[model samples]
Target: MNAFEINGGKPLRGEIIPQGAKNEALQVISAVLLTEEQVIISNVPDIKDVNKLIELLGDLGVRVEHLKKDTYSFQAKDIDLDFFMSEQFKAKGGSLRGSIMIVGPLLARFGKASIPKPGGDKIGRRRLDTHFLGFEKLGAKFNYNSKTNFFNVDASHLKGAYILLDEASVTGTANVIMAAVLAKGITTIYNAACEPYIQQLCKMLNRMGAKISGIGSNLLNIEGVEKLGGTEHRLLPDMIEIGSFIGLAAMTGSEITIKDVHYNELGIIPDIFKRMGIRLKLRGDDIYIPSQPHYEIDTFIDGSILTVADAPWPGFTPDLLSIVLVVATQAKGNVMIHQKMFESRLFFVDKLIDMGAQIILCDPHRATVMGLDKQVQLRGIEMTSPDIRAGVSLLIAALSASGRSIIHNIEQIERGYQDIDIRLRALGADIKRINTMPKQH
Candidate 1:
């Protein structure tokens, strides 16, 4: 296992570039299975989950070439259908949550797809009902093996239909969209997840000769195409990482500039941080956060306590609520963090409270943080990272604390962020990766 040894109280400076979007990479990479032609994708983040998915693709007979740093070309000309039923597939496919996405494209291209139960963060109940239900609506037969914990979908001919999704799930929407692209006739999807990642996938599909309308809206119309060709696509900078940087800057009182962040796509992120009293400026494509000794939380217009909550696209992303909650610990006022998406994400507050931050765990979905206002410096301690976002939040908290902190299970962090220690080190952060042996039972 790996851990992070961070000496807190060092204010990071210098400009840093955010990596390509992990979420976007997962969707687009899976879409490569939709077409057999060579598809080149640039700006892919070099992270654990993304790399794992790429490795899985290669094992499944996709010709994956590493063209350059953060660039890859995939040609799925000869997919081994037998591999899907092999034990190797179960072990590899079950490890990543994103692996479930391959079912859509495979079912569309090969008429059958099977996958073991997927894994990622242990946040909460992340149901796959939306995904299988969407596929069922598109004329695919779905089956589940409870004993093996596997899912299978088969379609002799996928015909389009009006699919009113039960929820606006981003992955579900992407999966259904991929399945519908090569389907027969037009497919109408209402209440679709229109995140920037989904929009990028739709655009990339269109570039590859897939007919998809409603680029930025909840209602998407996809006219089934006979086949799709290859196309080059570039991923946007990771919005979650950018938001984490902003929160890191404010919490550590650092003057930092984040480069090449697509500002237009980061809906409600900048505004939400701005409401927390962090002073930042937009310099062309970069975001500049100045050093601040004190930042106060804002209240509602009616003078009620400010609440930061997560919703679907066009609303605040649920991914950044953990970062926002961590950043609020040092602000001048209080704020309630409502994590509407996951039930267990707020449980990390106990670690923050142990470090002397004033936080009340209202429930599984909410936490009220009373800002310390620089009057008290958080004392560092040992902690374990539960998930990706919480791990990064604890890293930010460690960066702002006094003395030193050791964060175990840093693989969770590396699963999402690429070379985080290296990037933070460039910005003068006293953080390093340390190899640790597992404790004997």
Candidate 2:
């Protein structure tokens, strides 16, 4: 196991660049299965989940070549449909929630797809109903064996049709788009997710000759192309990582700049973070957060506490709520954080509560965080990272605390944040990464 020992109360000072978006890369990489031509993708973060997906793709007969440390070329010219391998994939599917995206493309192109229950954050039951429903509209049938937790999909010659997804799920939207890109006719998807990450996928597909219209809108029209050709694409910087860095700088009372942020892609990130009373000058696409001694949450004109909630595209992202929640802890006011998308996402609030912050857990999906408002400084304690976002949240909490803190299960953090300890350490963060075993207690 891996863990981070952080010496708290140290202010981070330095400039940092965010890594590529893990969520985007996951879905984009899976889309490679739709073609038999070589696709060169750059700006790929070398994280655990991406590495795992690459390994999984390689094991499934895709040839993945590393052009550079953070760039790769993939060609799924040949794929072996072994039932055992498909079952193994399903068993690990939830590990990277994005892996489910391959189901639609695989069924459409290869006639069948089997992936065991994919693993990811245990925040809630993220249903694949919308994904399967969209796939069904394109001529796919699904069956599941509860005993083995196996999911299998089969379809022959996906037919283009209108698909209205139940919810604008990011993954579900990508799944249908991937499948419909090569359907027998034109496909229309309404209520489609238009996140920048999804837009990137749509653009990449367009580059490879897919007739996709409405690049950045909720309604997408894709005319089926017989095949997709090889293309080169670069991933946008990870907005989640950018948000995490903003939280890190604010909590540590540090001055730091984030480079190459792709601000155009960050539709509402700047405004969302502003709700916590932070406003930074944008130097081109870079953002520089200055150190503030006393950060305050922006209050309403009527003097009532404000709430920060996440929603579908054009709104704040649900993934960054954990980071925002941690930032609210140090801010000088009360703000309620409503994480409407996931059930267990607020489980990390208990850790903040342990650190002398006041947070009322309304339920599995919401928390009313009464900010310390820079009055009560949190004391350091040992922490275990439960998930990717939570791990980073704990790290932020630890760095802003009064003493030393040890964070275990750091691999969860590594699954998303690339060279996290090294990067933070460069910014004056006193963090050490080490392998851990049971201590004689």
Candidate 3:
């Protein structure tokens, strides 16, 4: 296994660019399957998950070409539908959660789609109910094979209809929107996810001749067309990464500038950090974080303690809560970190507690963190990363702690962040990547 050996207590400095949005890349890449013409995408993050998806696409006969770094052209004129039923797909398709999204475009264009049980971070139960139900709403037949652990959706003629999602699930909305764009009628989606990723997807589809309205709201109207054409799209900078860097700068007392953040699309992220007393300066399209020796958490106007929590779009993203919680460990005052969306995400706080931070794990969803207030420095310790976000959060913690720290299972971090060690090294972080085998006793 590979691990990161980090020498902590050194502040990172210099400018780092946030990678293209991983989540958006997944959604947009799947959208390429909707058109037989060439769909060119730029700003694609070269990460493990995305590369895996691209391999899957190539396996299905999509003409994939690397035009340049961070840019690619995909044409699915000769798809191999038989590949979906092959044993190879059974192994590969089940390895990534993004593989499930291919069902939408395939069902839209080819009238049928199938995928093995999708796998992702074990943060919590990520159900595919929304995607399947939305497909059924648009005149598709859904079935699950218990014997093979696969999902199948078929629709010979899709006629769009109204869909009100249980939750504004981002991938679900994207799947249904992709399907609806080529359906027979109008599809109205209420309670839809309006995150920047979804907005970009809508805009890209519109450019490809799909009629979609209500770009940045909870309700979206899509008019089905006969076919979609090729279009070019560029992904937004990853907001989660930007948020992580902000927390990293504060925790390690580093002066850092995150370049090309696409600031207007950051929603409530910057304001949320401001609530934790971290100062941020917006310069054109970048975010500059000055070195902070100490930052005090804010209290509510009613004299109540501050609570940082995750919500749907336009609210704090659940993906960044781990970074926020870790940063809170060194801030002044106490705050409650509530991870309502995922039950198991807050369990990582136990690792922070082991490093001499004061944290009370109230339950699976809530934790009360009493900040160290820069009065004490955390001592580095060995730990294993449980998920992508948690891995980066631990890396940030290690960078701000004293002594040496080793992080195992760094592959989880690489699944999302592209060239993380190289990027962090550019910012003067004392981190080294190493491979090791377990010692036999």
Top-scoring candidate (lDDT):
1
Question: Each candidate's lDDT (Cα)?
Answer: 0.95, 0.87, 0.93
- Which structure is stronger by lDDT: 1 or 3? 1
Poorly placed runs, candidate 2 (over 4 Å): 83-95, 437-441
Q: Each candidate's TM vs. the true structure?
A: 0.99, 0.96, 0.99
Runs with alpha carbons beyond 4 Å of true place in candidate 1: 437-441
Query: lDDT per residue, candidate 1, 1-441, as tens digits?
Result: 789999999888999999999999999999999998999999999999999999999999999999999999999999999998999999999999999989889988888899999999999999999999999998999889999988988888999999999999999999999999999999999999999999999999999999999999999999999999999999999999999999999999999999999999999999999999999999999999999899999999999999999999999999999999999999999999999999999998999999999999988999999999989999898889999999999999999999999899999999999999999999999998888764332
Worst 10 residues of 2 by lDDT: 83-92
**For all the candidates, what are their Cα RMSDs to the real structure?**
1.1, 1.7, 1.2
Candidate 3 segments whose C-alpha is farther than 4 A from its true place: 438-441
How many pairs in model 1 have backbone atoms within 3 A of each other, for residues 3 or more apart or on separate chains, i.e. clashes? 0
**How well does model 2 score by local distance difference test?**
0.87
For all candidates, the clash counts are: 0, 12, 0
Q: Which pairs clash in the backbone of model 1?
A: none
Scanning candidate 3 in windows of ten residues, the lowest lDDT window is: 432-441
